[model samples]
Target: MKTSSPNTLTEKLKSRVVLIALFVGSMWAVFFLSVALPFLHLNEHGVVPRSLDGLQGILFAPWLHASVGHIAANTSGLVVLGWLCTWPNIAGFWRATIGAMLGAGLCAWLFGAPYSVHIGASGLVFGYAGHLVARGYYTRNLVSILVALVVVSSYGLSLLFGVLPIYPDVSWQSHVGGVLGGVLAARAGAGAANRVRVR
Candidate 1:
């Protein structure tokens, strides 16, 4: 990969920080509006399994939450892991997010219990975690490996529980799909980055 000068790298890092902040801020803003505008009934926009109408939820579900608590639980993880996903750059982050949203939404739509709605950013959070961990194994980069280690150490145990069906209300299917999507993102991204370096 072409090395960036110190000034350029610093500027890039600053931009990344801004990007993450704006993304998370938007989520919070949406949540606040959902609260302020009860007539909007934004929660109804979440993914409803096995219904044709639910298909649109794939685009909106990640931004909707059942309650303030639901969004609150998702906020910290989304901010931290979301920022990590962007470390390689915004394009990779967008790829990971879109991939996870589609994968997780499709999984829930296909296998989730009928007449159920799934909302929250947990799936995307899982995707970010999975991407961070898998990128190390795929790329064999020291920085990626170190990042993987940190992610594993911080959230590995929770991830195991999150993917299981032990919690009746939780969407384990989304978790599974998120993991697959994240690994796929890591593979594609690492390959692309390596090719760039080779050229």
Candidate 2:
């Protein structure tokens, strides 16, 4: 009988500063824009424009949002999903992060629609959701599967609605793009994480 003693990618942290820093930093920045400078409309400069003629849209768009509510929603999702996506395997963690940026940027480029300035890490959220689901199935890990299910259940109860033309003004294309980014990243990183476990 084979006993399953899988290698742990990351044991609980010696200090929570790194994670807390990321979490708090994300929240703080978002809140600053939402509450502090929202009246000033400080984010007009960083919308995810349909065209990436300048790198500003690609680089800074995700950080800016249309409204305080928009930033707040994305911030909340980030606080929870950001940690979950990166907390496990070190390899997968980095993969997801890079992949998410790549995915969001790609989505912003491809399906941004005309004059449809997009922004926020929702694309990255979709990217993480895609990563969790794909990683779970590929690795045959129950945790990944449960995570995928939870993502589907909570984050996207109306996954198809997000994909289809159910809601106007919302870019489902970015969501799809993020999913593609996540799949690519998870596929690449899964093997690497598994390899580390076996070694």
Candidate 3:
């Protein structure tokens, strides 16, 4: 493992601050819609909402939410996972996002039934969860293991309830799908991290 550069902590911490700002900015924009935008529910539809139609289909869903509570929960999760995965670089950040997208998109297409609408960053969260666990296993990194432990012990594992049909609107398909994507991302990230260190 690489040793931390004490002098670089300032730069790394500054980058982390920027990441926090971005996270807040995104939430603020979405929250604004949920509040000021009376019809915000229009975009709440999963991944461009089948209603929107066309290339817009590619945009991520869960960037919107049904209510303040919804966005609040996702915001918290993103901050926690975002910080954990992207310690001193944007590579992990984008990697996790792509992983989430891949996980959510595939699961929505494969497991999600046609005509059904799925939304929420829960899929992304699951992906982050899977990525953290797998990354830790692949690299034998302490931080990754610690983050995964915290995620499983706290939010990710207990939320299996949300994945079940106990609630009519929950999209377990997205949840499960995101997790699968995260696993793939973790494998890729481990290899990438290793390559970077060697050269």
Candidate 4:
């Protein structure tokens, strides 16, 4: 059986790291650009509940933020959880991200206050966490289970509280929707893997 050499594995790891860095870098870039050009009003692009114009936020909201503190709060979660999603394969990472974005955006639009605009990568961060945890449940593998346990131990409280509507400024709807999306993605991925194995 031919296997990847050490150098190849190292290269693959480096590539994945670069991908994560680029993604996070893009978020920072957007934040700085929005700050520098306030006239652009980039934040206005965020999900505006039930408004026809706000539908665009489904694709743009995850890339927008209100302030440095807002983006900073989400940065660490995105970096750590995003890196975790890249494991086993890179396709999984995209699945989680896209799923999270759509789910979170839709939920915020559906459930958010009538006049409020929801923005932030917190939804995606929550989505990554949800994906990792659900992947363990669906895959029933030792590595996945270990990863899930780590997530639970580290983020259990946040995950629980984040979905509740206790904080007026926070979008619990997005977090809940992101988690649901991540779980569904995990289920879909597991089903596809099972079919592939069966064939």
lDDT of 4 at 111: 95
List, residue by residue over 1-199, the lDDT tens digit for candidate 2: 9643444222345233376467447645865766675677545544455555524655565666666677666665665666677646445656776787677676666656666666666767777778877887777778888887887788776455665656876767667766777878888877877798999
Which residue pairs does candidate 1 place in steric collision? Answer: none
Off by over 4 Å in 3: 1-7, 39-41, 48-58, 196-199
Q: How far does residue 193 in candidate 4 sit from its true spot (Å)? A: 0.8
Of the two candidates 3 and 4, the one with more favorable TM-score, higher being better, is 4
Q: Give me the displacement of residue 187 in model 4, in angstroms.
A: 0.7
Error of model 4, residue 22, in angstroms = 0.8
lDDT of 3: 0.69
lDDT of 1 by residue, 23-131 (tens): 8788888888999998998878878888998888888888888778888898898889888888767887887888788888888888889899887788898988998
RMSD of each: 1.7, 4.3, 3.1, 1.0
Off by over 4 Å in 4: 1-3
TM-score list, all predictions: 0.93, 0.76, 0.81, 0.97
Residue-level lDDT of model 4, residues 104-194, one tens digit each, is: 9999999999989999999998999999999999999899999999999999999999999999899999999899889888898899899
Please tell me which predicted candidate would have the highest lDDT against the true structure.
4
Candidate 4 residue 63 C-alpha distance from true site, Å: 1.0
For each predicted model, how many residue pairs clash, with residues at least 3 apart or on different chains?
0, 0, 0, 0
